[model samples]
Target: MRIELVKGVNLNIIPSKQFKTTRIFISFIKSIESKKELAERALLANYLEMCSQNYPTQIDIARKLSQMYGASFGSSVDRRGNYQLINFSIDYIESKYLVGNEDLLSGVIEFLKEIIFNPLKVGENKNFDEETFTRQKNNTIT
Candidate 1:
């Protein structure tokens, strides 16, 4: 095959559909020694997506998103194209939709900070939050 490469573009917009922007969505690829570790890692990784220090719990996070004209927020895991992926997404109506969204941009950024920075890990040394980790583990199977 001929050597070829192409550059990709990042697009930003403030359109009618969404005044808020996509926080982040990228895949991760790494080796897992065993099936169990794969399961465990996936669990912890997902829990971070659930909430953050600011949000603290799933329901509180959900409520905030809901207040933003039914904005949607959450995360998911996938194994595809030889990579293990954790995807986080937040969607909210534009500030004009409600006319009082002074923090829409910052809120989106804070949520992204939580997702990429917080990940599933466990132990006494301050890893994943145990309660959230366990809940994610149980829920992942279904």
Candidate 2:
């Protein structure tokens, strides 16, 4: 089932008793005016997924995800006609499948929220982390 969480956002929940994992996807869509903008958007997507304000390094993020029963986090950019879409996805084993009755879903959701809403910034300029941005940009270019 899908529900409107706010004015411009929606939450979709699909339940299946036969599946062992749950997946959540959040996406942002906007028109791409030019190639430069598209490139910047793609780089931004990469940077956001790589690190956030709370998780400042790739290893830190990975370790946190590992502690949460090996949940997976990812982001990507896609083109649909004249628009660009940025998607953030999280997947984790269902609580029923985990040992000791742990609640991995809540932790995964919180981490995803942090990744989307609280990104690593450079000093007081409010810009993305320079090191992270440069790394992602170079990786994207090659």
Candidate 3:
């Protein structure tokens, strides 16, 4: 998928016409929030990148991917101009690569759903995960 910057908005999707690939995609997002807000969001983002019920530990999750050959998955937090974008996405390699005969698309969807719906929350505030929040705050101070 080709990634091109846009003028405004939160998200965008682009497809590859030059490459004859099916069942594949790449996504882009642009976010605008105060650094303070992003700092808060970052912590929650960090914790959610951990163990979930379907896969209890980081190693467990990695093993699942190994079983599936290789499923590209992860999240990234960064700044783009005045925007701080946190893009969570997956790119399916159609029916040609190192994946199950029918598991690629489903796996991508499930991965996204996990992050979107189950991100760790701050104990009392509508902010970030506590451990990440505290750690980030401490790091910033130093």
The number of the candidate with the highest TM-score is: 2
Candidate 1 residues lying further than 4 Å off, grouped into runs, are 1-26, 29-34, 100-103, 119-124
Model 1: lDDT equals 0.61
lDDT of each residue in 54-120, candidate 2, tens digit only: 9999999999989988888899999999999999988889988777878876677678778887899
At residue 109, candidate 3 shows an lDDT of: 56
Q: How far is candidate 1 from the true structure (C-alpha RMSD, Å)?
A: 7.2
For model 3, residues 1-142, the per-residue Cα lDDT tens digits are 3322233422344545555233333234446567677775555454555545466456866776565446655656777787766656554455554435454555555655555555545455655555555665575456
Number of the candidate with higher TM-score, 2 or 3: 2
For every model shown, what is its TM-score relative to the native structure?
A: 0.64, 0.90, 0.56
For model 3, what is the error of residue 77's alpha carbon versus the real structure, in angstroms, after optimal superposition?
1.1
lDDT of 2 at 141: 99
Give lDDT: candidate 2, residue 22: 87
Clash tally, candidates in order:
3, 0, 0
Stretches off by above 4 angstroms in model 3 are 1-33, 98-100, 120-142
- For model 3 the local lDDT of residue 142 reads 68
The positional error of residue 78 in candidate 1, measured at the CA in angstroms, is: 1.7
